[model samples]
Structure formats: C-alpha cells, structure tokens
Target chain A: DVKVTQSSRYLVKRTGEKVFLECVQDMDHENMFWYRQDPGLGLRLIYFSYDVKMKEKGDIPEGYSVSREKKERFSLILESASTNQTSMYLCASTLETGDNQPQHFGDGTRLSIL
Target chain B: SQKIEQNSEALNIQEGKTATLTCNYTNYSPAYLQWYRQDPGRGPVFLLLIRENEKEKRKERLKVTFDTTLKQSLFHITASQPADSATYLCALAPADAGNMLTFGGGTRLMVKP
Candidate 1:
C-alpha cells in the first residue's frame, strides 16, 4: 500500500510566523502536490512539484512556496502565517505524471493561525 | 475561466439505498474525471476514475459515469451503509501528461441508519 505521511497532524501558529509543513511519500511518486481545504471554498491547490527542485504554481499560490530537495520529501512553506491561512493542509503524490492516475494522500495537517 | 461545481454541499439518504452525486464543469475539457472519498478530518482517498473515452466505470458498490458532451459526471454508491457516509470530491484533468486538476467543492453524503 502507498503511504503519504505528513509531519504534523495538528499545528498552531501565531500570525507572521513562518510555518513549514512537511510530507513524505514512501511510493517515490514523480508528482507531489500541496492543497488547502476550507469550508464552501473546497480544496485549492497551492503548489506542486514534478521533480526535485521543480515547482509549479497552482490556483492559489500567493502566500505559499514549496521545496523538493529530495524525491521522497516535499515541504510547503507559509512565508508569514495569517489568521486567514488557518485551514486543513493536504499532501499528495502519484506514481507518475499521468492523467487518470489516482493520487495517494497523507492524513493532513490541520493548521490554526492565531 | 475554468470551474467545477458539485451538486450540493450535503446529501442525506437512508441506508441500503443508492446515493447519487453530481459534478459539473464548464469552460474546459478534461481527458478524465475522478471521484474521491474523504472522511471528516482526513485527506481524500481515491475511489474511481472514468476517462472521456469511457462512459462508465465500476468498483464493487461504487459506479461513476462521465459524459463529455454534457461536461458532467455522476457518482453513485449502491446499497450504501452507515460506513459509506463521507464527503465525495470530483476532479477533472486535461490530459495524461498534465496532472493538474480542478476540483469541485465536494458533496457530503450522510447515510442514515
């Protein structure tokens, strides 16, 4: 079975704090993604990496950045966390960069910015 | 602009019945559509995928139908049980090489016992 692990299941941070959310996948997938989910708004993509050191901006990438220094690790960085940034963060990966391939996701990190 | 709309925020159905969820998209064409199940406080789990070339796909009690002309996809769960209660999300992909997806808000299904 494919396992995508998020470093923190729950995190609390103050406004203007730099936040880093870590994720690792055991499957060694070529595609990795970061998404933030909120009520009524749905899951909005933040950033994605197809290869190490390569990143693409998703629909909502204004206050976020990503790093893929290694094949198994991907990190989402919030430059300065704000109250509005409080939401559920999810990480996902796929075996390949194909269209119909299902993505495996981590449990998620519930971030609360005070 | 590209957009995806789910049928509703929530749907309620009695156990042992069929639950139907709808996902509609506009201003874009997708090579395939996917359905995912997510429990409260958990990440979404892959359920089924249906391509444009295929009208329907099934996995046990779950079935998905895609209509490119209509730009719509329908997900159905047969003989649903209490355990089937969860939020279902639908996503659209342009082509195989591009895995970028536009996801709908999702429909939360609550199966009553």
Candidate 2:
C-alpha cells in the first residue's frame, strides 16, 4: 500500500502570518500536487511538482507557492495568510504517465486563518 | 476553458439499491476519467478509471462508464451499503504528457439502511 502523510492535520494562523504545509510520500512517486478544497468551489489545484526543484502553477496559485527539495517531500507555502485562505488542503502523489498510475492522497490538513 | 461538473446535490437511496452519479465535462477531450470516494474529513480514494476507448470498467461493486461523445461519465455502486455513503468526485486527465487533472464538485451519497 502507498502512504502519503501530511505534516499537520489541523492548523490555525493569524492574518498576515506565513504558513507552511508539508507532505511526504513513501512511494517515491515523481509527481506531487497541492490542492485547496472549499465549500461549493471544490478542489482547485494550487501547485504541483513533477520533479525535484521543478514546479508549475495550477488553476489557483495566487498567494501560494510550493517546494520540492527532495523526491519524497513536497511543501506548500502561503506568503501571507488571510481569513479567506482557511480551507482543507490536500496533498497527492502519482507516478509519471505511461505507468497508468492513480494518485494516492494524504489524510489532508484543515487550515484555519483568523 | 475546460470544466468538469458533477451533480452537487446529495443523492439519497435505500440500502441494497444501486446508486448512480453523473459527471459531465466540456471543451477538452480527456484520455481517461476517474472516480474517487471521499469520506468527511478525509482525502479522496481512487475507485475506478475508464479510458476513452473503453466503454466501461468495473471493480467488485463499483462500475464506471465513459461516453466520449456525450462528454459524460457515470459511476455506479451496486448493492450499496451505508458504508458506501460518501462524496464521489469525478476527475479527468487531459490528453497530454503532464496528465494534470480537472476535477468537478462532487455529489454526496447517502445510503439509508
């Protein structure tokens, strides 16, 4: 079984503070993604890393960035947290295409910005 | 712009019945479509995947159908139990190398026993 783990299951931060969400996968998948899920809006991709040190912006990337310094770890960074940024964040990983791989997700982190 | 839409209304059904969920997309042709199950407070778990050329795919109690011409996919859970209740999301992968997905707002399923 594949295991994707997020650093925090719950987090609270004040407005203007910088926040970090960490994710690690044991499967050594080449592709990792960060997504924020909001009520009614659904899951929107924030950023994704196809390989170490390579990142791409997804649909909703404003005010957020990502880091992939190693193959097993991916991190999501919020430059300045705001109340609107409060939502559940999910991390997922999958092998590159041509392998017919499906993404494995972490439990998710519920973030609260006050 | 490519977009995926799933019925946002919760689907309520009696136990031992089959529950069907719908997903529709527009603008882009996907190489494959995927269905996922998400329980409250947990990330989604992959359930099934149907390729464009394939008409349908099945895994135990779960079945998925893809209609490329209609730009729609249907997910079916047969003999559903209360444990089958969850939000079911449909995702699509573009026909390119990256395989980035576009997801729809999920439909919540409630199985009454």
Candidate 3:
C-alpha cells in the first residue's frame, strides 16, 4: 500500500509569521501536490512538483511557495502567514501523470493563523 | 474557465437504500473522472474512476457512470450503511493536462440506520 505522511497534524501561528508544512511519500511517486480545502470552496491547488527541484503554481498559489529538493519530500511554505491563510492543508502523491494513476493523500494538517 | 459542479444539497437515505450523487462539468472535456469519499477533518480517499470512453465502472457496492455527451457523472452507493455517511467529491482531468485535477464542491450524504 502507498503511504503519504504529513509532518504535522495541527499548527498555530501568529499573523505575519512563517509557516512550513512537510510531506513525505514512500511510494517514490513522481508527482506531488499541495492543496488547501475550505468549506464551500472545495480543494484549491496551491502548488505541485513533478520532479526534484521542479515546481508549478496552481490556481491559488498566492502567498505560498513550495520546495521539492528531493523526490520523496515536498514542503509548503507560507512566506507571511495571515488569518486568511488558515486552512486544512493536504498533500498528495501520484506515480505518474495520467488518467489511470490515482493520488494517495496524507492525513492533512489543520493550520490556524491568529 | 473550466469548472466542475456537484450537488451541494445533502442526501439522506435509510440503510439498505441506494444513494446517488451527481457531478457536472462545463467548458472542458475530461479524459477521466474520479470519485472520492471524505470524512470530516480527514483527507479524501479514492473510490473509483471512469474513463471518458467507458460508460460505467464499479467496485463492490460502489458504481460510477460517466457521460461524455452531457459532461456529467453519477456516483451510486448500493446498500448504504451508516458508515457510508460522508462527503463525496468528483474530480476531472482534461486530456491535455498532466495529472492536474479540478474537483467539484462535493455532495454530503448521510446514511441512517
């Protein structure tokens, strides 16, 4: 079975603080993604990495950046956390890019900005 | 802009009944559609996937149907139990897009015993 693990389950940060969310996958998947899920808004992609050190901005990438220095790890960074940035962050990994591959998700990290 | 929409209304059904959820899309043709189940405060779990060329796909009691003509998909859960209560999300990937998925808002289903 494929397993994706997030470094944190819950986090709290003050306004303008920096926040980092880490994710690691054991399946050696080539694609990794970060999304923020909100009620009524659904899951909005923040960033994605297709290979080591390669990144792409998604639909809602503002105020967020991602790092993929290695194949097994992906990190989401909030340069300056704000109250509006509080959300449940999810990390997912897929073996390849296509319709046939299914993404495996981590448990998610609920971030609170005050 | 490409968009996906699912029924926002909550569906309530008694045990042993079949629950159906609808997913509709506009402005883009998807290569495949997928269904996922999510519990409160948890990430979604993959349920099933149906290709544009295929009419339907099933896994045990869960079935999914995709209609390219209407750009719609239906997810059905047969013999639903209380354990089946959760939010169901539908996702679509365009043929030219690489692994990127646009997801609908999702439909909440409650199964009563």
Candidate 4:
C-alpha cells in the first residue's frame, strides 16, 4: 500500500509565528502537492512540486510555500501564521507518468492559527 | 473563470439501495475526471477516474460516467452500505494542466442501515 505520512495531526500557532508542516511518501512519486481544505470552499491547491527543488504556485499560494528537498519528503511552510490561514492542510503525491495516475494523500494536518 | 460543482450538499439513502452523485464543470475542457471519498477530518482518498473519451468506468461496486459535451460526470454506488457513507468529491484535470486538479465542493452521502 502507498503510505503518505504527515509529521503532525494537529498544530497550533500564534499570529505572526512561522509554521511548518511535513509530509513523507514511501511510494517514490515524483509529484507532490499542498492544499488547504475549508468548509464550503473545498480543497484549494496551495502549491505543488513536479520534481525536487522545483515548485509551482497553485490557485491559492499567496500565504503558503512548499519545499521538496528530497524525492520522498515535502514540506509546507506558512511564512507568518494568521487567523485566516487556519485550516486543514493536506499533502498528496503522485507519479509523473501520466494524468491517469491517482494521487495518494496523507491523513492531513489540522493547523490552527490563533 | 473555470468552475466545478457537485449537484447537492448531502444525500440520505437506505442501505442496499444505489446512491448516485453528480459533478458538473464549466469553462474548461478536462482531459479526465476523478472521484474521491473523504471521511470527516481525513484527506480524500482516490476512488475512480474516467477519461473524456471513455463513456463509463467501474471498479467493483463503484461506477463513473463522463460526458465531455455536457462537461458532467455521474458517480454511482451499487448496493451501498452504511460504510459507504462519506463525502464524495469530483476533480477535473484539464488537458493544458500538467498534473494539477480542480476539485468540487463534494456531496456527503448518508447510508442508513
């Protein structure tokens, strides 16, 4: 089975503080993504990396950034946490082969900015 | 702007009955569409994917149909059980996009025993 492990299940941070969310996938997929899911708004893509050290902005990338230092790990960073940034963050990875490949997701990190 | 929409916010059905969900999109040409199941507080899990050229696809009890002209996809679960109750999400991948997906708000299914 494909395993996508997230560093934390729940996290709390004060406003202006920096927050980091980590994700590691054992499937050796080449593509990784970060998304924030909220009530009624669904999952909005924050950022995605197609390969190591290469990242691209998604629909809502203004307040978030991502790092893919190695093929197996990806990290999401909040430059400065804010109340509006509190949401359930999800990390997913998929093979770069074709669009037909399904993305495997981590359990998710519920981050709260107070 | 391109948009994806699910037909309803919630659906209630009895066990053993078939559950059907609808997904629609506009202003974008998607090469393929996918369905996912998400329980509360958990990330969505991939369920099925149907390409634009494929009229229908199935996996065990789950079935999906895609219509490029109407830009709509229908997901059906046969003999749905209580365990099948969860929020179902539909995502679209446009041909122009490399691998990014656009997801709908999702419809929550409640199957009563």
Candidate 5:
C-alpha cells in the first residue's frame, strides 16, 4: 500500500505568520500536489511539483508557494497567513504514468488562522 | 472558464439500496474522469477512474458511467452499507501530460439503517 504522511493533522497560526505544511510519500511518485479545501469550494489546487525543483501553479496559488527539494517530500508555504487562508490542506502524490494514474493522498492538515 | 459540478446536497438512502451520485462538467474536455471517497477529516481516496473512450467501468459493487455528449458522469453503489456513507468527489483531468485536476464540490451520502 502507498502511504502519504502529512506533518501535522491540525495547526493554528496567528495572522501575518509564516506557516509551513509538510508532506512525505513513501511511493516515490514523481508528481506531488498541494490543495486547499474549503466549504462549498471543493479541492482547489494551490501548487504542484512534477520533479525536484520543478513547480507549477494551480487554480488558486496566491499567498502560497511550494518546495520540492527531494522526491519524497513536498512542502506548502504560506507567505503571510491570514484568516482567509484557514482551510483543510491536502497533499497528494502520483506516478508519472502519463495521465491515467490515480493520486494517493495524505490525511491532510486542518489549518486555522486567527 | 472550466467548471466541475457535483451535487452539494447530501443524498440519504436506506441501507441495502443502491445510491447514485451525479457529476457534471462544462467548458473543458477531459481525457479522464475520476471518483474519490472522502470521510470526514480525511483526504479523498481514489475509488474509480473512467477514460473518455470508455462509457462505463465497474469495481465490485460500484459502477461509474461517463457520457461525453452530456458532460456528465454517474457513480452508483449497489447494496450500500452504512460504511459506504461519505462525501464523493469527481475530478476532471485534461488530455495533457501533467496530472492537473479540476475538482467539483463533493456530494455527501448518508446510508440509513
């Protein structure tokens, strides 16, 4: 079975703080993604990395950035946390098998910005 | 202008009955449509995937149908148990190389005993 691990299950941060959410996958998948899920918004992609040091912006990438220094780890950075940034953050990884592969996901980190 | 839409209302059904969920999309062509199951406080889990060339796909008691003309997909669960209750999300992946996905607001399913 594939395992994707997020560093935190729940996190709280004050406004204007820098927050980091970490994710690691054991499957060594080449593609990793960061998404923020809000009520009525579903899962909107924030950023994705196809390979080490390679990143792409998704639908909603404002105020957020990503780092993929290694294959197993992907990190989501909140430049300046705001109350509007509070949402359930998810990390997913998948093999580079063209476009037919299913993404394996972590449990997610519920972020709260006060 | 691309959009993926799923029923936001929770679908309530009796146990041992079949439950169907709907997903619709517009303004974009996807090479693959995928369904995922997400419990409360957990990330979505991949359930099934259907390609644009295929009309239907099944796994165990779960079935999915895709219609490109209508830009809709239906997910069915036969003899559903309470354990089958969860939010189901549908995602559209374009025919391009990357795994870019556009997801819809998931619909929650509640199985009553």
Candidate 6:
C-alpha cells in the first residue's frame, strides 16, 4: 500500500510565526499537491509540484510557498502565519504517467494560528 | 472558473441501506471525476475514479456514475454500515489542471444503527 506521511498531525502557532508543513510520499509519485480544507470553502489548492525543483501556484497561493527539493518530499511554507491561516492542510501525490490515476493523500496537519 | 458542488447538508441513513451522494460541476469540462472518503480530522482517501467515456464504475459495495452532458456524478454506497459514516468528497480533473484535482465541499454521511 502507498503511504503519504505528514510531519505533524496537529500544530499550534502564534501569529506572525513561520510555519512549515512537510509531506513525503513513499510511492515515488512525481506529482505532489498541497491544499487547505475549510468549512464552506472546501479544499482549495495552495500549491502543487510536478517534479523535484518545480512548483506551481494554485488558486489560493497568497502568503504560501512550496519547496520540492526532492521527488519524494514536498514542503509547504507559511512565511508568516496569521489567524486566518488556520486550516486543515492536506498533502497528496499521484503518479506522473498514468491514465486517470487517483491521488494518494496524507493523514493531514491541523494547524491553528493563535 | 471551475466549480464542483457536493451536498452541503449531512445525509442521515439507517444501517443496511444504500446512501447516495451527488456532485455537480459548472463552467469546466473535466477529463474525469473521483470520489473520496474522509473522516473527521483526517485527509480524504481516494475511493473511485470514473472517466468521461465511462458511465458507471463499481467496487465492492461502492458505485459511481458520471454524466458528461449534465456535468454531474453520483456516488452510492450499498448496504452501508456504521463504519461507512463519514464525509464523501467529489473531485474533478480539469483539462488545464495538469493532473491536479479540484474538490467539492463534500457531503457528510451519518449511518445510524
């Protein structure tokens, strides 16, 4: 079974603090994604990486950045955390070459900015 | 803008009954659609995927149907148990998304014993 592991399951940070959320996939998937899930807004994509060293901004990329230093690891960085940044963050990965392949998701990180 | 809409209200069903969920999309033509199950405080797990050419797909006790003309997908769980209670999300892979999926708000299913 493919597993996607997230660094933290729960985190609390103060406002103006820097926050880092890490995701690693054991499936060697080339495509990785970060999303923030909220009550009514659903899961909004924050960023995605097609491969190592490549990143793309999603719809809600403001105040968020991503780093994919290696193929299996993708990290989401919040340069400065704010109260509104509190959300359930999810990391997902999918194989690069496939026909309608589904994404595998990590357990998620529930980050609360106080 | 691409949009996917799942039932915002929670669906309450008795055990041993089939639960059906709906997903509708607008302003986007997706190459395929997917369904996922998520428990509270957890990320969603991929359940099933249906392509544009396929009308219906099934696995175990779960079935998914996609209609391109209406831009809708339906997910059904047969003989649902208490363990099946959770939030079900529908996602779409837009042609321009580069393998990334856009998800819906999700419908929460509560199976009562």
C-alpha positional error of residue B25 in candidate 3 after TM-score superposition, expressed in Å: 0.8
lDDT of 5 by residue, A1-114 (tens): 999999999999999999999999998799999999999999999999999999999989999989999999999999999999999999999999756788899999999999
Alpha-carbon error at A88 in model 3, in Å?
Answer: 0.7
Q: What lDDT is obtained when candidate 4 is compared to the true structure? A: 0.92
Give TM per candidate: 0.97, 0.97, 0.97, 0.97, 0.98, 0.97
Off by over 4 Å in 3: A97-99
lDDT of each: 0.92, 0.92, 0.92, 0.92, 0.94, 0.93
Better of 3 and 5 by DockQ: 5
Minimal lDDT window, size 10, model 4 chain A: A94-103
lDDT by residue for model 3 (A3-110), tens = 999999999999999899999999999999999999899999999999999999999999999999999999999999999999999999999844566778998999
Q: Model 4: share of native contacts present?
A: 0.62
Tens digit of per-residue lDDT, candidate 5, span B21-100: 99999998999999999999999999999999999999999999999999999999999999999999999898884677
DockQ of each: 0.73, 0.67, 0.67, 0.71, 0.82, 0.75
> Can you tell me which runs of candidate 5 are displaced by over 4 Å?
none
lDDT of 2 by residue, B27-74 (tens): 979997888899999999998888899999999999999999999999
Candidate 6, superposed: residue stretches over 4 Å from native: none
Docking level for model 5: high
lDDT (Cα, tens digit) per residue for candidate 4, span A1-114? 899999999998999998999999998899999999998898999999989999999989998888889999999999999999999999998988755678899989999999
Interface RMSD of each: 1.4, 1.5, 1.4, 1.4, 0.9, 1.2
The better candidate by TM-score, 4 or 5, is 5
**Top candidate when judged by TM-score against the true structure:** 5
Which should have the higher DockQ, number 1 or number 2? 1
Instruction: Write the residue-wise lDDT of candidate 2 on A1-114 in tens digits.
Output: 999999999999999999999999998799999999998888899999999999999989999989999999999999999999999999999988674457899999999999
Instruction: Residues B31-79, candidate 4: write the lDDT tens digits.
Output: 9899999999888999998888899999999999998988899999999
Model 3: docking quality category: medium
